[model samples]
Every structure is written in C-alpha cells, then in structure tokens.
Target: MSVAGVGEFGLIDRVTARLTYGSTVLLGPGDDAAVVAAPDARVVATTDVLVEGRHFRRDWSGAHDIGRRAAAANLADVVAMGADPTALLVALCVPTDVATDWVEELADGLGTEAAGVGASVVGGDMSASPTLTIAVTALGDLGGRAPVTRAGARPGDLVALAGRTGYAAAGFTVLSRGFRTPRLLVEAYRRPEVPYPAGPQAAGLGATAMIDVSDGLLADLGHVAKASGVAVDLTRDAFEVPPQMRDAAQALGVDPYAWLLAGGDDHALAATFPPATELPPGWRPIGRVAAGSGVTVDGRPFEGPAGWDHFR
Candidate 1:
C-alpha cells in the first residue's frame, strides 16, 4: 500500500517493528529521543544525504540497497575516524505515492547493516517530499584510540588501501549507459562492500592519515594531501584491475584506471603509515609520501577533474 494510505505513525510502526536494537542503545526506536552510550567520553558523528536521481535512482537500486548505501555513507566516515559506530538516527523524506513497504525495506536495510557492526538504528523521522531523500547520522565511539584525520601524513610514509576501488565507477558507467553489465559490476553499484574493521584496525596500527574513497580516489586523496601538506604520488603499477570489472570494462571499451582514479562511492580506506611499519592485514601499498605538495598520478600532475562534482 502507498504511504498515503497508512499515514505517518502507521508507517513508523511498521518500520520500527523490524528493528533489532544494539548494546550501545540505551533507548531505541519509539522514544522521543534515543539515548546511546558514549563509552569513550567522546563521540564521533557523521551525516550524509542521498537524494533521488542525484545519489541513487529507483530504477537502478532496490529500497534495501539504497537504505544500505545511505547508512554506509555516514557509517564509513565514522569508521574512517578510527571509531566503532554505535547507533544511527535517520530522516526519511518520501513522496506520498511511494509504497509503504518500500520504506520498510529501506529501514530493514539500514538496521541490518548497522547491526553488522554492533550498532542499531535508534530513532528517525519521516516527512513527505516531492522526491525520495534519505539523511542519516551515524554515531560512534573511539574506544580510547586517537581519531584518525586527513592530516599526519608526512615524507617517507607508505600509502596503502584496503577494500575495492573502481568497481563502483565501472558499475555507475554501465548503469548510466543503459547497457547490459555483468552481475558483479551491477552489484558493486547496488551494494558496496565496506571493509568494516579495517578503519579502526588501521588506527590501532598507527596509521598517520586516512580517508574514505567517496568523491573519487584522486579527489579524496587530495584532501589528505592538502591537509597534511605532503606530496602524494600514487603508483599506477600498484593497482591491478579486479576480476569482476576486467571483462566488463573490455566490453564497454572503458579504461579501468579512469574508474580507479576518478570513480567515487567505492568507500575503500586509503591510509598512510610510517615507513617500515608492517601494514595491518588486508591493506597493501599503493604509493608514497614526499616533502612536496599536492597529489600526483605516477609522480606527475593530474590535469582533469579529480572526481564527481555536485554542482557541475
């Protein structure tokens, strides 16, 4: 049934029924305001908005996947700061004509993904809008570890990455072209595989700087480069096209490196560590830090747009 039939409270009931509250939740859904624990005395919070046609399309993704993607967007940022995410407060703005069940599935996706990391959806509000929009705020605890920031990278540091890159961009390219793409490529866009433990683990292992690959690898790294004031020259030879996108790229006549360098939404963790420090498992070296400034592709200047632009 459409949300217009059930009304707001009824729809909220349906969504809340499916949630499984986590340990960090002192009070959960149905409360006027949720009370979540801040065991580390400092809370790490991040928020993101996913707008229809901008961040996602109804034709390309299911409600469940969209919900997961929305939650991941903020949760990944908290994790990148070297924290364990604990709870989420979501705000949903939906068109009256959208099915109520679709919203419920979205909530299920959010709750399920949050639960995976011992977190829960604590509370949220719904509103009517002309289009579908989801805004999620993720809260986390540092567990006494220093929050990793985009700064701290310096000369003589090793650049490393964990999790997949380029796949999401390739997937986006396929979807945008309205052409048939492989299942793996499609799923990469629909459901990103975020390496949950890697962020906190990297911090524990003394990572000097870190950021998630959201706006595109090069563009996002430029943040670290600017923040740390260190020149970052990424080694092109270090990246090997993943098996999932190789054949698809061949068929599409797209360069894999373009996606790796320019694609966003992959959500992989790129970090810098002191030279000679053994990288935490699952992370491999990709580049190095220099005493100079800005970002480089194989030691040369990158001349194009680094990644996706919201206004352009």
Candidate 2:
C-alpha cells in the first residue's frame, strides 16, 4: 500500500512496532520525544542526510540498503569521536506515492545497523515531500574517556587505519557501468561495513587523532593534517591492493589507487598514535606524521582528487 493509504500514525506504528532498543534508551517511540541515558555526563552527537537521487538511486538500492547506508554514515561519525553508539533519531520526508512497505524496510535496515553496535532507533519524524530524504542523528556515549578529535596528532606520530577502504567506490563504478559480476564491490556501495568498535578502542589505546573515512582516505587525512598542524606522508607499499580490485581495475582500465586513495563511503577509521605504541588488533600502520602541512604520498602531493566535495 502507498504511504498515503496508510496515513502518518499508522505508518509510524508499523515501522516502530517491533524495534528493540538498547539500555541507553529509556523511552522509545510513541512519545513527543524519546529519552536516552547519558551515563558519561556528556553525549556525542552527529547528523547526516541522504537525499534520494543525489545520495542514492532506488533502481540501484532498495529502501533497506539506503537506510543502512544512512545509519552507518552518522553512526560512524559518533564512533570517530571515540564514543559508543547508543541511539538514533531518524526523520524522513517521502513522496505520498511511495510504498508503505518500502518505508518499513527502511526502518528495519536502520534498526538492524543500530543494533549491530548496541544502539536503537529511539524516535523520528515523518513528512510528505516531492522528493525522498532521510536525516539521521546518532548519539553516543564516551564511557568516560576523552573524546578524540582531528587536531591531536603530533609530528612523529604513527598513522594507522582500522577497516578496509575503496570497496564502496569500486562497487559504485561497477554498478554505474551496468556490470555487477563483482558482487562484493556492489554490496559495499550498498552498505558500508564501518569499523564501529575501532574508534573507542583507539581512544583507549591513546589515539592522538581520529576520523571516519567518509570522504576518500587522502581527503579525510587532509583534514587531520590541517587541524593537527602536521604533515602526513603515506608509504605506498603499506597498502596491499586486493586482487579483486586489481582485476576490476584491469577490466575498467583505471588506476586502482584512485579508489584506494580517493574513494569515500567505506567508513574506515583512520587514526594517529604515538610512536612505539603497539597497534591494536585490526589496526594497521599506513603512514607517519611529520612536521609540516598537508598530506602526501611518498613525500609528494597526490596526483588526483583527494576526496568528495559537494561544491567543487
């Protein structure tokens, strides 16, 4: 049935009826505002919006995949601040002609991703619009540890990364070309596998700085470099390009490094740690912090675009 047929209240009830909230949520749906626990006396919050046609295409991804991607983008930001994800407040503006089941599946996707990191969808708002848009606000707890920012890296610190990168961009390329033989890449673009735990873990292990690789790796690292007032030099040899990526690159006749270095949406966590620190599990050393400005590959500027830019 179309959303207009279900009406607002009925649609809300259907989407929220079976959700499971974590302990951080004291009250969930069916209220003017949901209540969440802030045990650390401070809450980490971040918001992101996904607009239909711009951020996603229904022909390429279902409502469920769009919802997961939306939730992951915001949740990853909370974790990047060295906090544990706790709750999500999602607001949707949908066309009246949209299917009600599509919205429910979207809700299911959001709930599933949140639950993966011990979080819940506490509340949200809905409205009618000509275009579809999803805005998610993610809340997190620090567990009493100091929040890691992008400005703490110092010269001589080791740069590390948690989780894989470039898969999503590669997937986008394959899908755009009307080829999906590489299911792995396409799935990545549909739903990123963010390294949620790595954020808080890195904080506990004395991460000097951190960020979620939402924009390409080099672009995001450029932010860290500017904020921390340090130069970042990446060793090209440290990254092992997956064979799948190589094969795809050969088929497409494009440099795989462009995806690895400049692609976004992977949601990997890149952090800087003091020298001599034993890296945490799943974290790999990729570069070093130096005294200077900007980011470089092998002591020189990267040849292509570093990451995503909305206006440029």
Q: Evaluated with TM-score, which candidate comes out highest?
A: 2
- Model 1 residue runs over 4 Å out of place are 303-312
lDDT of 1 at 281: 74
Q: How far is 244's C-alpha from truth in model 2 (Å)?
A: 1.3
- CA deviation > 4 Å runs, candidate 2: 305-312
Give each model's whole-structure lDDT: 0.88, 0.91
1-312 per-residue lDDT for model 1 (tens digits): 999899999999999999998789999888679999998999999999999999999999999999998888888998899899999999999999999989999999998889888999999999999988999999999999999999999999999998888888888888887964777878888888899799999999999999988987788888999999998999998888887677877777777777777788978989999998898679999999998888898889755442233211
Backbone clashes, candidate 2? 0
Q: Report the lDDT of model 1 for residue 295.
A: 83
Tell me the TM-score of each prediction against the true structure.
Answer: 0.96, 0.97
Q: How many backbone clashes does candidate 1 have?
A: 0
Q: Residue-wise lDDT of candidate 2 within 51-121, one digit each (tens)?
A: 98888999999888998999999999999999999999999999999999899999999999999999999
